[model samples]
Target chain A: MATARAYTNIALIKYWGKQDPQQMLPYNSSLSLTLDQFYTETKVEFLPKQTNQTADSFVFAGVAQPVSPKITRMLNLIRQAAGWSNFARVETENHVPTSAGLASSASAFAALAAAGAQAAGLQLSPRELSIFARHGSGSACRSIFGGFVVWHAGHDDQSSYAEPLLATVDFPIVVIAVLVDQRPKKVLSSAGMQQSVATSPFYPAWVQTAESGIATMSQAIAAHDIARIGQLAEANAMQMHATTLSAVPPFTYFAPMTLKIWQLVQEFRTKGLSCYITLDAGPNPKLLCAKQDAAAVVKKLQAALPQLQCTICQPGPGVAYRD
Target chain B: MATARAYTNIALIKYWGKQDPQQMLPYNSSLSLTLDQFYTETKVEFLPKQTNQTADSFVFAGVAQPVSPKITRMLNLIRQAAGWSNFARVETENHVPTSAGLASSASAFAALAAAGAQAAGLQLSPRELSIFARHGSGSACRSIFGGFVVWHAGHDDQSSYAEPLLATVDFPIVVIAVLVDQRPKKVLSSAGMQQSVATSPFYPAWVQTAESGIATMSQAIAAHDIARIGQLAEANAMQMHATTLSAVPPFTYFAPMTLKIWQLVQEFRTKGLSCYITLDAGPNPKLLCAKQDAAAVVKKLQAALPQLQCTICQPGPGVAYRD
Candidate 1:
C-alpha cells in the first residue's frame, strides 16, 4: 500500500474555458500557488480479484461510496498505464470542505494519482503524474508541484502538464481567504465554462489575454514585483468572471459581500498598504498581500467585517508520498 | 424665454468609456429608446446684466441652486455659439430623480441644449442640437430623437451626432424599471469610465463588440423582433459591467438585490415568458418585454420582490419646445 498527500492551489491567473472539451484541453495557460493549510491524503491498495466481485471500490471520509464515472475513468487510465489486472481499493481523506469555494479536487486527485500509481508498482515522474491527475480534474495538474507553478496549454494530452515556475523558495507572499459562503454553487465550474465558451462573444478575448499574460506574469514573479503580479492576477480573475456575465443567460459568482470585499481592498490600498483581490468560480474573495502586512490587513478586515472568517496561508510543497 | 422637454433613454447598447474626453465622443455607437414616463423641462432666458451680479443663475426643482461647474461649462458653449454676452437665467424641472440610476442627465442636458440654443436666438437643426448636447453629456445626444435612436461615433465633434433610426412610432416593447436603490454610487460614471479605459485589458474587446453589435441590433429593431432586440440589449449591458470588473481596482454597481432580480428574469423566461434585463451604472435593473405581457410580468416580479417599485414605460417623443 502507498499513501500520498497533496495541497490545494489557488490560480492567480484563471482558467475559465476549455479548448477541447473531451480531452480537457484548456483555453489558456495559468499560474498558481499551492496553499500550506489545506490538503488531502489518499491510500491505494491492489486486492486480488475474487470471482464475481466488484473490480474497484472507493471509500471516502470513512464511508464506502459507489465509484463515480469520472473516478472509474481515471482508474482505468492508471490500470492501463501500470499494466495491472488486479482490482484496487482506494481510501481518501479530504482536509478541506468538498464543493466549497476551496479547490478540494486539485488536492484530492493529485494524491490519488500519486498513491494509485505507486501501489500498482509503477514509478512515474512528476510530469507524468500531472498528466494523469489532469485526467481527473484540469486544475489538479497544477497540484503536482508547490510554490509558483504554471500549467501550460499544450496542444495534446502528451504535452499538456504543469511544472514549477521557479525553484521552491520563500517569497514575501500571503493569501487571506475570506469564506463568505461554503455552499456549493448552483452552476458548477464545468457547466459554467461550457456555457461561456458556447455563448459569450467576449470569451475569445479572455483566452487571448490569459494565454499572453503568462509570460508577463512569469517576469513579474522572477522580479518579485508584488504590485505588478497582484494587478495582473486581479485582472486575470476579473476577465474570467467577465465571460460569465457576458454569456447568454448571464450569471455571476459574486455574492453581495464579494463586491464589499473588493471595494475594501481598494480602500486598503488608498491607505498606503499594497493589497489586491482575486476570486475564482465562487462567491468567496481572497486577498493577496505581502507577509509583513498580513497581520495588520487581517485586523483591519476583521474590524470591517466582524463576522467574516479568514485563513492566512503561504506556499506549500508538491505532492509527496508517505510510508 | 424658451422651454423644452426631453425624455430620458435607457441604452440597449451601453456607452461606458469616452474616446475624446473634451468633446465627449464615445468609444462605441449606442442605441436607446426614449421613455414616456420620465423627463426634464428647462427654460432658458438671456437676461440683461446687472452690475456686480453673477453671470448665470440656475433654479432646480423650484429651488434656487448654485450653478454647478458642468452647468457653467455648458452655458459657456451655448454663449460662444450664439454670440450672446448677456447673463442667462435657467430654471429646470425634473420629472425623474437626478443621479439615481435614472438617465436624468440625458433628459436634463438635451432639454437644456434645445432651450439654450433657441433662447439665444440660434436656429439649429435637430442634428446640430444633438452635437450641442454631446458637449454636455455623451448619452444626452441620443435623447434628442424619439423611439429607436442611434448615436453614431464619428471621427470629429461635427460629424458625431444622434439621429432617429426610424420615424417616431410605437413598437411592441415595454420597459419595467425596478428601482432597487435611489442612493448615488460611490464611483461616478465619469471616473469609472476613465479607470476602466486606462486599466481594463478587456475594454478594447468591449468597444469592438459594442460597435459590431449595433448593426445586428438595428436589423432586429427593423424586424420588430422584441426577443432578439431584448437579448442583444441585455448582452450589451452585461458587457459594460464586465469592463468595470476587469479594471484595475475593480468596481461594480451591483447590489445583492440587483443580482436577485437578474436571476428572477431568467426564471421568468424558463416559464415561457420573453423577458430580458438591462442595467446601467447603478443598482437598478430594467426588464424589456412586450407590452401585451407587461401586466403578468409585473405581477410575477412584485410577488418575488414585494418591496420593488416598478414603472412600466414605453417610447415617447423627441426633444421639442414646450408651450
Candidate 2:
C-alpha cells in the first residue's frame, strides 16, 4: 500500500479553454500557487488476481462509493502505465471543500497519480507523474509542484508538464479565499470552457493574451514583485470571465455579492492598502495581499460582508508519498 | 427657439473606449438601432446680449438645474462649431429614463446638437449634425439617423460621422427593453469608460475585435439576417462589458437578475424560440427577437421575474425638427 498527499493550487493566470478536450490539454500556459491550508490524501492498494476482484473499488471521505466513470478511467490509465494487470482498491480523504472553486480536483488527481504509481511498484519522476495526472484533470499537473509553478502548454502529451520556478518567491504572500457558496455551480468548468471556445468571439485573443501573460508573470515571480504578480493574476482571471460573458448565449459566474467583494478590494486600494482579487468559475473572491495584513484585511472584509468565511493560505509543499 | 427630438439608439457593436477623449472619438466604428419607444426633446434659444445673460441656463424634467460642467462643456463645443458666441437657454425633457442603462445621453445630446445648431441659425446636414453630436457624446452620432446607422470612427473630428445603411432591413425585429431598476447607476458611463481605457490590459484587443465586429455586423445587416445580427450584437455588448471587468479595481454593471434574464434568453434559444440578449452599462437587459414573438417573450419573462417591466419598441426615425 502507498499513501500520498497533494495540496490544492490556485491559478494566478487562469486556464479556461482546452486545445484538446479528450486529452485535457490547455490552449494556454498558466501559473499557480499551491496552498498550504488544503489538500487531499489517497491510499492505493493493488489486489492480486487470486483475490478475484473484477473491478476497482473506491471510497471517498470514509463512505464507499460506486466507481464513477471518471475514477475508473483514471485508474485504467495508471494500470496501463505501470504494466499492472491487477485491480486496485482506492480511498481518498479531502481536506479541502470539493466543487467550490477550490480546485479540489487538482489535489485529488495529483495524490491519486502519485499513490497509484507507487502502489503499482513504478518509480517515475515528477514530470512523468504530472503528465499522468493531467490525464485526470488539466490543472492536476500543477499540483505536483509546490510554491510558484508554471504549466507549459505543449503541443503533445509528453511535452505538456509543470515545473517549479528556479526562484522561490521570498515575500510573504497571503491568499484569502472568501467562500461565498459551497454548492456545486450550475455550469461545470468543463462545459463552460467548451462553450466559450466554440462561441466567444474574443476567445482567440484570450489564448494569445494568456500565453504572453505566462512570460510576464514568470519574471514578476522571479523578481519577487508581489504587486505586479497580483495585478497580473487579477487581470488574467477577469479576462477569463470576459470570454464566458462574450460566449454566444453568454453566462457569468458572478453573483451580486461577488461584485460587492470586488468593490471592497477596490476600496482597500483607494485607502493606500494595495491588494488584488481573483475568482475562478464561482462567486467566491480570493484576495492576494501581504501576509502581515491578512488578519486586518479579513477583519475589514468580515465587518463589511458579515456572512463571508475566509481561509488564509500560503505556499505549500509538493506531492509526497508515505510508507 | 428651435426644438428637436431624437430617439435613443442602442449600439449593436458597442463604442466603449475613445481614441481622443476631448473630441469623444471612438477607437472603433459602431452600429446602432434607433428605438421608437424612448426619446429626448430639447429646445435651444439663444439669449441676446441685451438680456444680460452671461451663461447658458438649463432645465430638465420641469426642474431648473444649475449648468453642470458637462452641460456647459457641451454648449461651449456647439458655440465653437457654429461660430456663435451667444449664451443659450436649453430646456430638455427626457422621454426615456435617465442614466438607467437606457442610452438617455445618446438621445439628449443628439437633440441638443440639432436644436442648438438650428437656434444659432446654422444649417447643418445629417452628416454634419452627426459630427457635431459626437462632440457631446460618442454614441450620440449614431442617433442622428434612424433605422440602422453606422458611425464611422474617423481619424479627425470632421471625418467621423454617422451614415444610414443602404440596406434597410424590413424584418419584423422587436426590441424589448427590460427595466430592472429605475434608479441611477453608481458608476456613470463617462467615468467608467475613462477608467477602463486607462487600466484594462485587454483594452487594445477590444479595440481590434470591435473594429472587425463592425464590418461583420454591417454584412449581417445587408443580408437582413436577423439571427446573425442578433448574435453579433450580443457578443459585442458582452465584450464591451469584459473590458470593465478587466479594468484595474474591476467593476460590473450586472446585478444577479441581469444574469437571470440572460439565462432566460438562452433557454428561449434551446426551446427553438430564438431570442438574443444585450445590455449597456447597467442591469437592464434588452431582448431582440421577432415581432411576432415579442408578446410571448415578454409574458414568459414577466412570469419568470414578476418585478421586471418590459417596454416594447421598434425602429424609429432620425432626429427631427419641431416648431
Candidate 3:
C-alpha cells in the first residue's frame, strides 16, 4: 500500500494538440508552474487475485464509484511495466474547491501514477515517474516537478518527458485563480485538441510558435522577470485559445464573465498594475503577478466584482510519497 | 459637378490581410452583400486652377473640414486616370447612424470614386471604377455591385476588381445588426490587417483557407442555402478575428458586451432559432438568418438584452448616379 500527493499546475506555454493521441505525444513543448493551493492525494493497495474480486475498486471523496476507463487504461500500463496482474483498490481525495472551474486532472493523475507504481513494488526516478504519469494526462508530467517545468514534445514515448527549468522559484510570483463559471466544459480538452489538429487552419502556426515560446519562457523564469514571464504566458494562452476559435464548428472557452474579467485585467494594467491573465480549457481567468502586487490586485478585483471568489497560490513542491 | 450614391456592404467571406499594401491588393478573394439600410452620397466638383485654392476642399455632414489623406490619395488616383490636375471640392452625406459600429467606408469610398471620376470628365466602366476605389479602401471595390459581390483577389492592379455574383436576390435573407458597444475601435482595420499579415503565424493558413472559403461560398449562394451561407460567414469571421488574437501584441475586438450578445445568440440557436453571427474589426455583432426568422431573433435578442440596438437589413442595389 502507498499514498502520494501532488500539486496542480497551470501551463504557461500550453499543450493543446497531440501528434499521437494513443501514446499521448504532444505536438509542441509546454511550460507550466505548479500551484500550491489545489492538489490531490491518492492511495493505492494491490490486492491478490480472488474469485469474487476480479477488477479494480475505486473510491472518490469517500464514496465507492465504478472504475473509469481512464483509470483502467492507466493501471493497465502500470501492470504491464511492473510485470504484475493483481487488481488494486484506489482511493482519491481532491483539495480543489468545488465548482471552481479549474482542472484537477494534472494533480490527480500525478498522484495516482506515483502511488500506483509504488504499491505495485516498482522503483522509479522522478523522470520515469513523469513519463508514466503522462500516460494518464499530458499535463500530469509537469506536475511531477515544482516551480517552472517544461514538457519536451519528443518524437516518441521513450524520449518525451518533463524537466524542471527552475526547481525552486527564487522570485516572488503569485497566481490569483478567479472562478467565473461552474458549468461543465462543453468541449473536453482532449476532444478539443483533436478537433483543432484536424480542422483549425491555425494549428500549424500554434505548434511553430509554441516551440519558440518555451525557450523565451525559460529565459524569463531564469532572469526572474515577472513582467516578461506574465506577458509571454498571456500571449501563449491566447494563441492556444485562438486555435480553438478557428476549429470547425468553432468553439470558445470564453464565457461572458470571462471576457469581463479579461477586460478588467487589461484595464488594471493600463492603470499601472503589473498583472497578466491566462486561461486553460475553461472560462475562468487566472491572473499572474508578483507577490507584492497580489493583495492590491485581489482588493481591486473584489471592489470591482464583489461576487467573485479569488484564491491566491504560490510555488509548490513536486509530488511526494505520503506513506 | 457629379453626384453618386452607394450602399454599404457586409462581407460574408472577409477580406483581412493584404498581399500588396501600396496597390491595396488583398491576400484572398472576398464576398459581400450590399445593404439598403446604410449608404453614402458624394458630390465632386473640379475647381479651375487658382492661386488661392491650390488644394482640395472638403465638407462632410454639413460641416466644412480639412480633407483627409484618404480622400486626397483617392482624388490623386482619379486625376491621374483622367489626365487632369485641377483641384476638387468634395461634399459628402453619410446616412449611417451616429455611433453605430458598422463601417461606411465601402459605400463612402465607392461613391467618391464614381463622383470624383465623373467630375474629372473620365468616362470609365464599372470595373474601372472599382479598380480606382481600391485605392481608397480595399472593401470599397465590392460596393460597385449589388446583391452578392465578389472582390477578386487578382495578382495586380489591372486584374483585381469587383463583379456581381448574383446581381438580384431570388431568395429571402436578412441581417440583424446588433450594436453591442459604441466606443471607437482601439486598432484601425487597415493597421490591424497589416499587423496580422506581418506577425500572425496562422496567416498562411488563413490565406489558404480563404481561397477555398470563397469558392464554397459562391456555391452556397448559388444554391440559395441560407444556413450554409450563415455557417460559412460565421466561421470566416471567427477565423479572421482569431488571426488578430494571435498577432504579436495580441488584441481582440470582443468587448464584454460583445461576448454577452454572442452567448445569447448561441443560446437562441440551441433553442431552435436559425441564426448565425459575424463580426468585423469592431465589437458589434451581425446576426444572419432567413427573413422569416428575423423578427423572432430580434425579439429574443431584445428580451435577453433590452438595451441592444438591432437593425434589419436586406440585399440592396449597387452604386448609381444621384444627379
Candidate 4:
C-alpha cells in the first residue's frame, strides 16, 4: 500500500520578483506556514511491464488528461531530485479553492513533493525536502514546514532552502482569508512579475526595500507584534505590486470589488478590533486579527463586506504521512 | 512699462502624490532646477491708493480672465508670505510649453515672487524670496535658483520654507522635450497621489526605497556620474509615477505616441550615446544629453519619430533682469 503526504504554506512575508529566473532566487526573503486542513493529496501508483504505457496520466479535480509539458517538467524535476524511474498515475485532490488566486499551489505542490518522494521510498529531511520542493515552485518550498518557514536565499542552489519555525509564542494571530475572485488571472506569475521587474523603474528599489522588510518582519513576528508584522507585510505587498504598475503594459491584480472590501476592513479597524490586512498575488485580503474572535470575525466581515466569502483558517499541521 | 522676470523650473527628480490637500505638500520629496528660457515673465505693480482695483489676474496662454478662487487662494498665500500692505496688479507670461505638463508655475510663480517683491520695493534674499513663491506653487520655490534646489517639508501655516541651491558644479545637459498630448488631466495631482498613498500596498516600499534612491542620486549628480545620474533619475521618475497605477481609480499620464518616442529613444541609447530620458506629468519625454550632440540627436529622433516637434533647451540663466 502506497502512502500519501499533505502540507500547506502560509507566508509571513511573501516573495515576489526574481533575482534569477532559472534558479528562482527571490529578490527578498520570505516566511510561510505549512498547514494540514488544506493540502494536495497525491497518490502516485507506479505502472510497469505493460506493453504500451507510454505516457503518464494526471487526474486533477476529476479531469483526466495526459501530463502537460509544464506538469511534465515539474514531474521530471521531482524525479531528477529523487532519482526514481517509473511510469505512474498521479492524482491531486486540492483542499484549496482552485483558480481563486489563493495560494492553492503553495499547499498542492508541497504535498506533491512529500508524497512523490515517499512513494519512491527515498528518505528526505525537511531541508532536503524543501530544496526538492523549490524546483516545483518557489513558494512551495516554504510549505514543507509547519508554524513558520523562512525561505533562506543562500548563495547557490544547494545553499538556498526553507526552515520550519515554531513561533507558537504568538498564536493569537488568526488569518481571515477571503476568496474575492474566481476568475483565472490572464498571465502566469512568472511572466507577470518578470515583466514588472524588467520594465519597472521601482523594481530594484522594491527588491532592496523588501529585504529590509524581511528582517523587520521576522523580528516583529518573533516579538509577537501583530500590528508591525501586518503593517510590514501590507507595505511589502504594495511595493511588490508597484513594480507591476511601472511595467511597460501596466496590470494590477485588484478586481473591481477589492476596494469595497478594503474600505470596510479599514473602517472596522477604526472601530478598535486591533486588525490589519495583507494581500499577496490576489485581490482577496487576509485579515490579521486576534485568534480568540476568529469565528465571530468572519460573521462580521460577511455582513459588512457582502461581496466576500470569508474563511477563517487557523495554524495547521506539518507535513506527515497519510493512511 | 513693467519688466518681466522669467525663470525655468527643471524637475531634479519629480514630484508625485500629495499628502495634504490644503497645503499641497507632496507625499514624496522632489528636487528641481530653475532656468531662464522656459520661464514665466511676471511683473507686479502695487497700487496702494486705488480702492476699486480687482485682485491678481493670470494671463495664461494668451487667455485673459478673472482669477479663479483657487488662484485667489494662492495670491492670498503670496500676499501673506510677502507681507505686502498694498493691492498689486500681477502680469505674467509663461515660457514653459503650454499644456505640456512641464514645470510652468515653478518659473511663473518664482518670477511672480521676485517681480512682486521688486515692485513692492521689498529687498529679499533668494531664501526669503522663495517663501512667497512656495505658497503660489510647491515647485515654484525651486525656481528661485538656477542650479539645484530642495524643498524642505514643513507643517501647517507657520514653518514651511524653500530655498535655492548653488551647487559647487553644474552641467548644461540638453533636454529634447517631446509633447504627446495637450489635454488637461482628469484627476488633479493632489487628489491622485493622496488616494494612491493611502491605499496602495506598494506605496510604503516605494517610500522606503526612495530614501536610498534620493540619497544616491544627490551623490551621483555631485560626482558628475552621468550614466549613474541618468539611470537613477529614470528609475526614480518611473517609481514615482508607479504609485498612480495602484490608485482606486487608476490614472495614466501616457499618450500612445509616447511609446513610439520611447522606442526610438531606446534605439538611440543602444547605439552608445550618453543619452537618457525622463518623464513627468505628461506623455512628453525629456531626453537628457550633451549640448554637443543635441542637434544630431534631435535629427536622429526627427527622422524616426517625426510626429513630435522636438524643442532643445539647456541650463540657461536663472530668474533675473532681462530685455
Which candidate's DockQ is highest? Answer: 3
What does candidate 4's lDDT look like per residue over B59-178, in tens digits?
655677677665565556556655765566666777665534465667777777777666756667777677667767777777777666666555553344555444422475666776
Model 2 segments more than 4 A misplaced: A62-81, A97-101, A166-171, A215-228, A268-275, A296-309, B47-51, B61-84, B97-101, B166-171, B180-187, B198-201, B215-228, B268-274, B295-310
What digit string (tens of lDDT, one per residue) describes model 1 on residues A1-323? Answer: 89999999999888788888778789898899888878999999888766455678899999999988777777788889978777778999988643235768899889988898889888888999998988888999899999999999899997889999974749889888888888888789999999889987778878888888899899999999888888888888888898888787667888778877887887898887778889888898888998888888889988999988888888888998999
- Across B201-239, the per-residue lDDT of candidate 3 in tens digits comes to 888899888888988999999999998999899889989
Q: For model 2 chain A, where is the 10-residue window of minimal lDDT? A: A96-105
Kindly give the number of clashing pairs for every candidate. 0, 0, 0, 7
The single-chain TM-score for chain B of candidate 2 is: 0.95
How do all models score by TM-score? 0.92, 0.87, 0.97, 0.61
Query: Looking at candidate 4, what is the lDDT of residue B155?
Result: 58
The CAPRI quality class of candidate 3 comes to: medium
The i-RMS of every model, in angstroms, reads 1.9, 2.6, 1.1, 8.2
- lDDT, model 1, position B310: 88
Q: Least accurate stretch of 10 residues (summed lDDT) in model 1 chain B?
A: B94-103
State the fraction of real interface contacts model 4 keeps. 0.15
Q: lDDT by residue for model 2 over B1-323, one digit each (tens)?
A: 89999989888898887889888788889889988888999999988878888889999988889987767777787788778788999999988644234768899889998999889877789999999889888888888899999999999988888999742435578788998877788788878888889977668878888898888988987887878888888888888898888676567887767877887887887776658988887888898887878888988888988878788888888999999
Clashing pairs in 1: none
Could you give candidate 1's per-residue lDDT for residues B1-323 as a string of tens digits?
89999988999998889899988988999999888888999999888666555679999989999998778888888999877787888999989633235768999999999999989888899999999998888999989989989999987999899999964658879998888888877788899999989987778888998999899999999999999998899888998998887776667878778887888888898897889999988889999998888888999999988988888888878998976
Q: What Cα-based lDDT does every candidate model obtain?
A: 0.86, 0.85, 0.89, 0.65
- Using TM-score as the yardstick, the better of models 2 and 4 is 2
Q: What is the DockQ of each candidate?
A: 0.56, 0.46, 0.74, 0.11
lDDT of 2 by residue, A76-125 (tens): 88889878788889999989643234758899999999999899878889
